[model samples]
Every structure is written in C-alpha cells, then in structure tokens.
Target: MNHLSRRAFLQGSALAVSAGAVSRIAAASLPEAVTQTQAGTQPPLTPASGRPYQPVVTLNGWTLPWRMNKGVKEFHLVAEPVLREIAPGMKANLWGYNGQSPGPTIEVVEGDRVRIFVTNKLPEHTSVHWHGQRLPNGMDGVTGLTQPGIKPGKTFVYEFTARRAGTFMYHPHADEMVQMAMGMMGFWITHPKDPSFMRVDRDFVFLLNAYDIEPGAATPRVNEMTDFNLWTWNSRAFPGIDPLVVRQHDRVRIRIGNLTMTNHPIHLHGHEFVVTGTDGGWTPPAGRWPEVSADIAVGQMRAIEFDASEPGDWALHCHKSHHTMNAMGHEVPTMIGVDQSSELKKISQLIPDYMVMGDKGGSMGEMEMPLPDNTLPMMGGQGPYGSLEMGGMFSVVKVRAGLARNDYRDPGWYRAPAGSVAYEWQGAAAYLPSAGGSRPAAPAASPSSKETVVNVVKPAAHKH
Candidate 1:
C-alpha cells in the first residue's frame, strides 16, 4: 500500500483512544532513556559529542533527451534557488536548487549503482558536497578539495554504488557558510538488502532553513545573524503556507538534514524516532533503537523512524528560538527611534530601555511572541546567534495521524510546508488601542484613505 494511506489508518487508530493524552505530550520534552547494548560493556552514543559522519553525492543539471533511453536510478543534486522568502508578504531572488530552497530529497537502496549527471545553471562556480556518504575521492563533490567546482553552464557525472543504508545529506562545500545559508541542502536515505525492516507506513522528509531579512524589505539577506530575518521548514514559514500531513497509526519515517553552517537539534513532539542509520551506513543490524530525539549537524543527515501510535497535529521543529524570526530582530539592540551608540548614549540614557528591552525583567515582548506550543527549536551546539546567549533556531512539524484527507479538519489559519522552518509574525503588525469605542465610520474616500485615517491594516503572519 502507499505510505500515505497506511499512515492515515494508523493515525486514525491512535486518535480514537489517546488523542487527549497525546496532545498533552506533543509539546513536552520527555527524558531520553539511556541503556547499554546486549554486550553491556560498550559505551552508548551520547548526545553531546557523537563522532561526526560524512555523506557525499554528485550534482549536475541537464535536460534528459529521448535518446537517453535507459532509466537513471541513482541521482546527484545541486542546491540552487528559483524562489525565496524575503520578508513578510515578499518573495525575493536568492540561490537554491530545483526551484526551491533545500533541494529535493533523494531515496535509494544499498548496492544500487547510482549514476548522477549534474548540470550547472548558476552563473558562478559551485559543487555539491555529500555530507556523510563514504565514496571514492572522485565521487566527492568538493569544489577544490576533491575536484574543481562545476563551472556555470557545465555538467559533471558522478558514479558510485550505494554501500550505506542510512540518513545523509548533500550541499555545496565551497563558500560553505554563505552558499548553504542561501538554501543548498537536502535529505538523503538509502535502504539495504532485506529492506523489509526499513519499511514503514509513511515517509516524510524535511530540509530546515533560516533566513536573515532587512526590516521593510521584500527579500532576505546574506549570512549576518544580526540581520537574519526569518526561519522556515523546507522553504516557507507558517500561516501563509500549508502544514505537513500524515494519517493516524502509521509507522512513519522522517529523514532530516541540516545544510547550513550551524548544527540543528531537531525534536518531534508526542513521539521519539529511532535513529536507524547514520551518514556512513546502517547500524550493525538495522532494527528499532531507542532515541527520543537526534541531533543533525550541518551537512549531516539522519534517518529516523517512529510509530504514529498517537494521533494529533504534532509539531516538528528545531530547538533554537531565535532562528525562527526574520532579519529585523538580528540587529544588536534591535530597535528604532533610539540611539544607544556612544554618539547618542549620553543624550539617550532612557532610550536604551525601549531599544534593547533586555534590561526589563528578561523580555522583549514582540520578539517573544509564543511559538505554536507543541513545537520547539533544536538547540544542539549553539543558539540562534551561535552562542548560548541568543537561543537556537527552531520550527514545527504537524503530524495528523489517523485522519484521512476527507476526514481531516482545518488546523486553524497557519500551516507550513513539509520539511521547512516556520515562524509567527503576529507582533509585527500595528495595533490600535481597544478603547471600547464604536467602530469608526469609513472616511468619505477610497479604502486607502480610510486606512490612512485609521492607520489600521490587516494582520498577516507569513509562514513557509
């Protein structure tokens, strides 16, 4: 059966009995269970400092001709952008692959001879870095390290066998930070012989992304965290987009990857995912393993499978809170109408309170608007600003278990696309005092004039 249909069935079963309890657990962080393996002597993989694994894939973009009669099962990728989120209600020109951020997820089986032809569409030089697959040096997509970066308007072919069955990722190793932040990462999964053990009722993948935007501008900017503007799942934010969907009671597999310079500790609500595979290969013998959550590093991939025994709109997101906002919040002291610099510090001692707001009882009311409760940020190595001080990046994954498409209910106003970061923008809109006064009459002019007279515009929180 198709994964989606099976997912619906399981979700429905889960919802009938434990909806309330599951809902309660959706947002709470459960403690991880630490145990020794059968040998009882080897150390377990600690969450703090697990050894880093690498995966790699080839990338080239080219049009397939009818003359190319044979079907190409193995594939490579190039991360580029055709559309981008610049600001609330604005899309911009940015770099990404396959017309979106977080290039497409690639799934394969072990021992398959994967052949990938990469065609370069960008005007500049770039290459694809497989995060954790151990291939021969020639198959590595390093620009200068393994091979020269693919030039614009060219194609490179990579051939390799799937020796590993696990979760891995791909991205550009050249200009590591900037290119990745611009949306060049995606999830990769491989299944080995006897794939039945890896089978599941549902499968989902996500590529997490963060954007830095300038206030009042339509497009997000480059990698200066101070000006970072928005966070997203896959590509878009919430409320302005759609949510990831799943059916009840389905055995689901979610392949997650982080492509940016920073690491992401992804958490799923209401359930824990089994870390069945890593970047290099499958666990000694792939089967269910106990792990409530997993930390996915930059350019790294992790394949996690879980049973959807509980049904509800579950949240999946990163743990860093600051990574969820648009660029405006990143500026130090983050405010206007106040001069906190040395030039104005003497004349504006009182203004610092309004500008920073950090001095007042540990709060910045607007920036602290509550994220959807069930969702949390993945605070693995650093917070949003690369240190514990700023918090970390985060997002939400909504799991609608057991409900068939026809049986599903609208999950309120905002929903995000599968595998992307999401944000809340309610505080960004202007507000008028609720003075218990009568509604003001429309001005004797165009609607624009009435809006100008009242200074009230509709509120819309942009989500990807």
Candidate 2:
C-alpha cells in the first residue's frame, strides 16, 4: 500500500486497540437518532462577552474559533510548526499552536464548562498542560502520568470547568524542555462571571517568551536553557510590538504571563498600579497595594490594573537592562575603565575600519557596529531626546485625552504644555532655597523676567 493508505490503516488499528471493549459498548448503547444528532448538529462558539471591555489586538493577531456543544464551549488547538517574526528583520522557525508562536489567547468565562481538543501534528508525542488551572487529575495533560501522550497524527481531548477566573497559560508537559524552548505556549484568560467584578475599560493580555537563536539563524537553539538572547513580549521584539493605547481616565488591566527562564520585573512609567490578580485569582483588597513594577517569575502570571489618568506616551518594559537588549554578548569584557586607544592607533593604520569602544563609558550603545543579517542591535531606537538605545521586551503605552473609548490607534507623541518642556538653559534663575531659609535679594525685573521662569537646568553633554 502507498504511504497514505498504510498510515491510515495503522492509525485505525491503533485506535481500535486503544479503545478496547469500552468503546464498542458505548457505541452500541447510543440510539441511532441521538447519534445522528450528535454527529450532525454543531453549536456556534462566541467570543467571551463582557460589555464595555475593549479587546486587546494582538500583534500579528490570530485566534481560534469556538463552538458551543450541549452548553459546553469547544475549542480546537493544533500543535504544529510555524514561522514567526521576532522583529522587523528577524524570523524564526518555531513549534507552536495554530500557526503562531506563543499561540493565540484562549478567553473564556468563569464557571463555564469547556472542552479543548488538541491535535498533535508534530513529529513526536506531545500533551497540553493547563498551567495554574484547577482541573481533574486525569485531564491535567501530563504525559505518561495523568494520561498517555497524543502520538503524532493523533488527537486528545481535555474537558474541564473553568472554576476560577484569572490569568493563566498552557504549554506542552511532554518534552517541555525542548517544546517550550521551541516556543510552544499560549495565554489563557478566564473572565469573572460577573462582568462588573474587577472590570476594566481595556483588557490586554500577552505572554513573555525567550529564544537563543543566533544571528542570521532561522531557528532557536532548543538546548540553551539560561543564556537566551532574544527576549519578547509575545514572540515579537521591540520596534515590532504594537503599543497599548487607551483613552485618558479609562481603567486598564494588563495581564502578563512569563515562560522565560528568568524573571521579568515589568515596569510602567508615570503611573503606579495595583496588583489586582494573579494565576491564583484576584488578590484580596487588603493584599492589593500600589506598585510601579511587578515581578513575574517563570511559569507565573500577574494581572495589574491602573487608571490611564495621564495623557502622554509612557514606557512599559522590563527593568533588567540585558532583557531590554537583543543578541547582546554576555561574555564581552567590561572596557569601561580600560583604554585601548594607544594600541588601536597602530591597528587603525593597517585597518582603517578599526575603532575603540567603551573607553570612557556609555559608548557601547552609541557605536554603529555592523550586525549580522536578520539580527537587531543590542540596543537601538530613536526617541524625542535622541537615541533610545533600547531593544527587546519594550513598548509604549499611549494615552490621549480626546481618544474615543473604542479607538485603539496610536496617538503619536505627546505635546508638552507651554513652558513645560525641558530645554537647554539660557541662563535662567540659578538657585533657590526653602521659604524658611535665606533668599537672594530681588533683582530689577527685566523684559524676560516678566515671562514665567522655569527652574530646569541642562547638564553638560557627555562625550562618547
């Protein structure tokens, strides 16, 4: 027989053996009409509904279709290979669910019975583990323990009731070391039954993933555990990640899941937020406290809520410097105090392109060193103040006062109010002390003095 026929025959034989007598008895007991209805009728699946909650648009977005079967929501997730872009110039071959790395977000309502069907299209066995969810032991998706793994070309089903509403995730429990490193993961969000409980105007969700793909390479080195180079918010690095836009004064909730080897201290500028919930569910009012940053460890999730009261473009990124860089050399020696100038003078005579780096300090990020094809600089980008010198795991949150509640478009940069922007000092007022302390004698008012005085000063610019 041909390859296709032989494979089909083998699969059928395996299923018959696997099913044994229980399958025959169950099939025989079902009435013909009931069986026909079950086979022909399919319910339509609707997106999780919570009025006034704005859906977050995933960068390079994709999502699975769901259907209601006998009041239970059914979702099909296929595990297969995919090509994913990390940034503008870099793309990698990865294994994920439904054609995207860090597979699509699965959103459902709490207390709903859901059935998820996972088909293994991978080359080897695989299983899905619902991380941080309370489910039956048999449906835990642990290969060879809770249940046998789904072999290649086979399918497995996991049915459970989403008892608690929180931010969670899913990944392969079988061969996780290799599977997860290859980018096989996705986000899971269970909204509360009561829409008003812990409600927000905008709900954003994303997974933090890391990879160690070498420069110019198209696939991640699955063997590397800790020394990952590319840090991503959703398998996409900075400059490629879409900004989180919200209307001024709107309540916002951002749910972040971390699957990388190291922890990420996610920081948001210009605002302090409360840790409203976690993988375990909403934090008690007493446990909630204001914070500017939240640390999410590997295999953990954090949900933070804040009011978009300020109108500006604020930064949201990991506080770890290296985590903000892409493809950085971890072993590069620190030359901050070392002077390679004298030696470089002779080297430059033979090679005109040779140049010294990190001599005085703060020059590493400023150097225009050549990088490999399909690779990003360790630190790069342009900002209002000049070179942003940032990469990986970084994005902006744009808030505007007149933005429509439903509009999620970027509003460009913020415009400063008159006399509010920092600029080079033109010899403004020099010093000031508390009203209780001694003060300088009042000087005669000049034409400029009539204008409002700004106490800001510009420090001397440093040389690289």
Candidate 3:
C-alpha cells in the first residue's frame, strides 16, 4: 500500500476508536440530564437519595435533580439554545442549560462531594465556572486558564467539594459577555451540615438577569452592557414571575444572586430585613443591620431574612424606577404641562400609532398603546384596583395567615378590612406653608404666544 493511503487509514481508525470511547462513556458513566420546559416554578426537590436537608423553593425556577453514584452527588447539565419567555407577550432566543435560562438551582450539603457532567450542544465551545466556589485549581472551570474550553458535542466533568455554605451561582467562563448576555446562569446553594443552622420556615432563590433585545426582536444584542431593555428575575418579568408566598409571622429567607451589569437596590414594602448570608458565608450576627432596601452589586449574592408579619400583598421590586419599565420609554421627550392638542391632528395624519405620554409623568400602566409584534407594553400587569404600572424585577410577597406548611400556590389577592384604606377628604384641601412666603403664579400663555403653537410630533391614532 502507498504511504499516503496508509496514513489516511490510520487516521480514520483513530477517529472511529475515539467516537466509540465517547459513546461508551456516555452510555455507562454519564447521568441523565434532567430538563423542564415550563416557565412556572416547580415544586422543591426534596432530598431523594442524599444527606437529609431542607430543600429550597426557586422563585420562577426549580431545583436540579441529582443522582447518587458511588457516594458522589452526580448532576448532568446540557448546554444549548433555548426559547425563554420573558413575559406573557414576549419571548427571547437565548443560550442556557437543561432547557431553561437561569437554569435550575443546585442544592448540596456543605461537605458532600459533587460531580457535574456538562454536555455542550451549542454551536461554539463553552465552559462552566462554579462561581464563588473553593475547589481544586483544575476544577475551577475557567476556559484556557484552568482547562481547555469544552468544544461542541463534547462532554466534560467537574469535581469538587462543597466547601462553603452560602449562595453561589454558575455560568459560562468562556465568552462570558456573549453567553451571559444571552441568558446563561443558574443558582447554587450549599447547605450547612447542621440543618438547624440558619434554618427558616421558608427559603427562596433566584437570579437577577438583564437583556438588550429590541422591541420586536427575538435575540438579544450580546455586545450591550449598560443600556439593557429587559430587566428580569430568573428570566421572567413582573406578572409572569410567581409571587413569593409565605405564612404570616413565619421566618423567611430570600437568597438573591445578581448577574446583571448594574446594582439592584431591592426594596420590600411593609417589612424590614437583614442581610444574613452572602457568597462568602453566613454573616456574623453583629454585622447585620435592619434595612428596608438592600443594594446588591453586580456578580454578588445576598441572602436577606425577615418575618412575614403583614397580611396583604406587598410590593418587592428594584428601587431604580427605570429598571421596572420595559422597552420604548427611555428616549421619550418630556411634555408635561405642554399644550399639544393643535399639533395632534396634524401628526395623526402622518402617523397612526404615535402616543403622547400622560401629563402627570411618562407612560401610564393603564394606557392601551399599540405595540409591534413580539413586544410587551412599557408598563403592564393589572391589579384588582387598577394597572400595576410595573414590568421587570417586580413581584409580590403574599403573606397569608392560614397557609399550609408546604403550600407554594398563589392564594389570590389580599382583601383589606373596612376603613383601612385611605379615602379622599370631601371638605377642604390642606395647603402646605410655602418656604419663601406666598408662591407667585406664573403668567398664562397668550393666544399669539410662540409657546402656544410649537411644532410637535404627530399623534398616533391609538390613545395613550
């Protein structure tokens, strides 16, 4: 045989042997990669075959199921393209693991040995970094730094001991900007060996994520960092995100991990909480102070605990007002107290969907505006009373008096008692004394004033 033909035959045989090896490895050693397609929160996965510990509820997400193999907790994660529903009317094409973005929460004991098998089904190579973990240098999962990137159609294994008991996260260490921007992330919890330590009646977990998709597009602009249009918790927006249900007077712990570029000042109404844990570990009791709002910096995890004393639906959301709004209101011009009625008819002739924002402020939640395909309203979600005027990073903490111990279902809206709500006064309005004596009245615009006839945008036929 010729030398070139012999070389080609040897290479082909080697390729065949490698393929057989990979197939044999998958068939005999790999665990099943469990996946879920629904966006709603799944039931907490109780310890099926591992050390006993209370499982946590993942808000708008679920706990990853693992199997015991030779004394090690085995988990399989498959990375691929996924279609994530950001809200009721909007969906995004993103990359994630196990069939969802902000993939399932992984819970393990503090001292247990863990093995994670990552199968790459993406178009490009990827890697998984166990954020905030103290593992072997080679098991750190940093592409090229700790190990080579897991190429497409390849499976890699990561082994480590759960050294810390706190809130941590997992995401790609390779092509981080694009992968994270495409909605790749998940939550991880290392439970203390003593289950009684830092115990709570109910515990919740989720990740804060953001996206920069256009109003009508399905894919995000992965290069964007600051000007994100969609702010989410576990890849879900308000109204779509399930409420954090808790029993009244019960101790609750909400573990939040921020993966977005900016900080989130998470605020809760009708109650105060204290930071009890972080990525490092449990916070010392003396270092904690009560706060109505806690600021979580980028790539940080914060676990806040509080007693659910209130009985009504309380608002829990980001303090940055812009973060709560969806697309299409960031570049709007201010027209408060301006007379644009004359120009409305002229503009309406040219455009059919131009909407003038409300007079009191910008877009109103109750306003019915026309939107492009695959787009959500700037302000959305209706409450029993009226429009909620909220979109992203918003949810309710439904504290009820008679909730079952394991009940995580929505209990509907809360009803206030008689005379508890504020009513308008029918007599006279009280006036605050001016700091600089009597307030001067501004001059009214005349018929011939230039301000009375300024050129404005054409109004859309749709009402705002």
Candidate 4:
C-alpha cells in the first residue's frame, strides 16, 4: 500500500482496538463506577474545623472541572485553536487550552495529588510547563530536557502532588516563543492547607498577556517580541474588562500572572496593598510591605491583598501609559511645536476634513480619528468628567458599603458629594485695594451686552 493508505489503515486499526478495550472495561467496571460516581457527587473536601480561610477565589472567569479517579483528580486540557474576543469589537484567532485562551483556572487544594492530561491538537508538537511548580525532575515538561515533546494529535500526562499553596501558571515549554505568543497559557492555583491562614472576603485572578497584531488583523504576529501593541488582562481589553466588585471593609486579594514579553507595573488608585504571596510561595508577615503598585515580571506571578476601606470606583491598571492602549502606533512622529495650521487650511481645500493637530502638544486622545474596523482607538472611553481616554489592561474596582458579602455585581458609578466637583468660574470677579488704599471698582459690563469689557488700560506701544 502507499504511505497515505498505510497510515490511514494503522489509525483505523488503533481506533477500533481502543474502542473495543473501552467497551470491555466499561462493562466490567459498571457497578463500581456507578458507586464511585455517586460518592464523587458529594460536597468537595473542606478544611478541618475552625479554619478561617476558605477557598473563595472568584476565578473572575471559569475553572476547569476534574474527574475523581480513586483519590486523585484527573483534568484534561486540550490545546487547540480558539477565536477569543479581546473586547466588544476585537477578536483574534489564538491557540489555547480547552477551547479558551489563558485556559480555565485549575484550582486544587494543597496536599492533593493530581493528574493532568494534555492533548495536543495543534499542527505542531507542544508541551506544557508548570510555571513555578515543584515536581519530579522527569515531569518538568521542558522539551528534550525532562520529557519528550507531545507530538501533534498525541497526549501526555503530568502527575504531581500539590506541595505548595500559592499563585502559579502554565504555558507551553516547546516552541514557547510561538505558542505563548499565540496565547497558550493558563492559571493554576493551590489553596493553602490551613484555609483560614490567609482568608480574604474576595479574591480575583487574571493573566497579563500581550499581542502584536496590526490593526484590523485577526491573528497575532508570533515573531514580534518587543513591539506588542495589544496589552490585555485575561486576554481582555478595558471597557470590556469586568470591574472588580467588593463590599466596603472587605479583605480582597488580587492575583496577577504575567505571560508577556515585558514586565508590567500594575497600579491601583486610591488604595494601598501588600505583596502577600508569589508563585514560589506565600510571603511571611515580616517580609511583606505596603505598596500602591507592584511590578510583575515575565513568567512571574504576584498576589496582593488589601482591605477595601475606601469606597468608590477606583482605577486599576498598568502604570505604563502605552500598556493601557490598544493598537498604539509607537513609530508615529511627534508633531508638538510644529506649525501645521496654514498647511492644513490649504489641504482642507482639497480634503474638506483635513485639520491640524498636535501643534501645541499631542492631542490624539482628544481627536476622534478614524480607526480600522474591529480595532480600538489607542485611547478611548467616556467618564463623568469627560473622556477617560484609556483602553487596554485597564479596569475599575467598585467598592460600595452595605453590599452583601457574596455579592459580586457592579454597583454602577459613584456619586460624589455636592460642591466637590471642579467647574469653570463664571459668576463674578473680586476687587482688591489699590496703592492709594482704596478698593478698585469692578469692571463694567459692555454697552452691547454681547461682549465683556476689561477695566485695565493697555500698555503704551514701544518703538524699537
């Protein structure tokens, strides 16, 4: 037979044999399996009596469910193509796990043994590296170093005990440059042994990822390393991002994992927090310090905790201004201090829409320039004051008093107290005493009432 015919015959034979074996096994284990399934439907394992910290992490997304095999949890993660929406109008074709980019968060309790089966559905070979995980040397998942790569259409199993409890992540170790750039990553969280040790009322988790896709393009350029334009949190841009909601005085923990090329200094307005844990493990009380912003480096994870004392809609975003924008053009020239008004007037004769911009300073944020379809403007958003002028990797933390402990709904915008808002001065002007010790009269209104009048006299013209 030819090569194609022989390959097809072999695949068919294998499938037939696998199906027969499954049928036999199912018939033999039917009774035992039913019992086990019934038992598995019971409540999940919980901490011993008096433990304060229960696992309350709101994946902020979703979690991967597992099968209970004996005493071990079995999870299946399939790496395949996915069409994910970064925001309302922007979507990209990416490679991720189990049909979603930054695949479902895997939450397990400490001391539990887990088995993860990763199926490679991509055209190329792939392997998953458990970032910051401690496992047998042979199960490290590094291609050629610890284990062989999982060839396309093949699956590999990784078994390990959850030794530490902290924030962690996973991504491909083989062709990492291409796979990670294509958005193959996921969050792995292990709950502490003593649940109440670091208990918090609310917990949020997300991954920081970047992509280099040209405006209007659907796929990311996997080769570009430093010039990424699409910055995202959980592969989502701002406005599309769900705000973090909490009740006043609630203890909150936010875990951030960075899988991008560069580091990000995540900043939070109107609050202070401390780095409580990392991928390595939890930080001791003595080792912790307060911070308004924390720098998370590539392949690193940081967990920050704070008390939601101040109630309002607070901005939480990357401190890097460019990181908070989408499809930003880094190569654009600076037009500040350049006189383009006269040229623009002439150009408008030919193109009626032509207008001069940035002559005094950069005004891209204020201008409603046209952008490609399915692309977000470099800076955009409306705020109570005016334009928020921000995009990617930005979100708000809505804290309100009297919200139920378990309520995670956004409470809408906060209303500021009266007389606190800044406004333009328009009512009247005050007068001061002159050098003769008498108050100067206020400026009189113009006779026409259509224009205002100035009381000061003009200086004499100089003859140079």
- Please report the candidate that would top lDDT against the real structure: 3
Once superposed on the true structure, which residue ranges of model 1 sit more than 4 Å away at CA?
1-81, 86-88, 218-220, 223-227, 240-242, 284-292, 331-464
Clashing pairs in 4: 52-196, 53-195, 53-196
Residue 222 miss distance in model 4 (angstroms): 0.9
CA-only RMSD, every prediction? 18.0, 12.3, 12.8, 13.7
The TM-score values for the models, in the order shown, are 0.57, 0.79, 0.86, 0.79
lDDT of 2 by residue, 76-171 (tens): 687898788777656889998876787766777788887777778899999999999999999998999999989998767788999988888999
lDDT (C-alpha) at residue 195 in model 1 = 45
Best by TM-score: 3
Every candidate's lDDT: 0.47, 0.72, 0.81, 0.72
In model 4, where do residues sit more than 4 Å from their true spots? Answer: 1-60, 345-355, 425-464
lDDT of 4 by residue, 1-464 (tens): 11111234233212111111112122221111100101000112232222223543333345555545555655668888877777766788998876568787777878878777777899999998888988899778999999999999877778899888888899888998899999999888888877677888888888999999898788999999899999988777765677788899999999999999999999999899999998889899999999999999988899999999998779999999889887878887888888887898899776554557667875455665545567766666555454567888998888899998667655666665544445444433422234334333333322222111111122234455
Candidate 4 worst ten-residue window by lDDT? 32-41
In candidate 4, how many Å is residue 390 off? 0.6
Clashes of each: 75, 1, 2, 3
Against the true structure, candidate 1 has what lDDT? 0.47
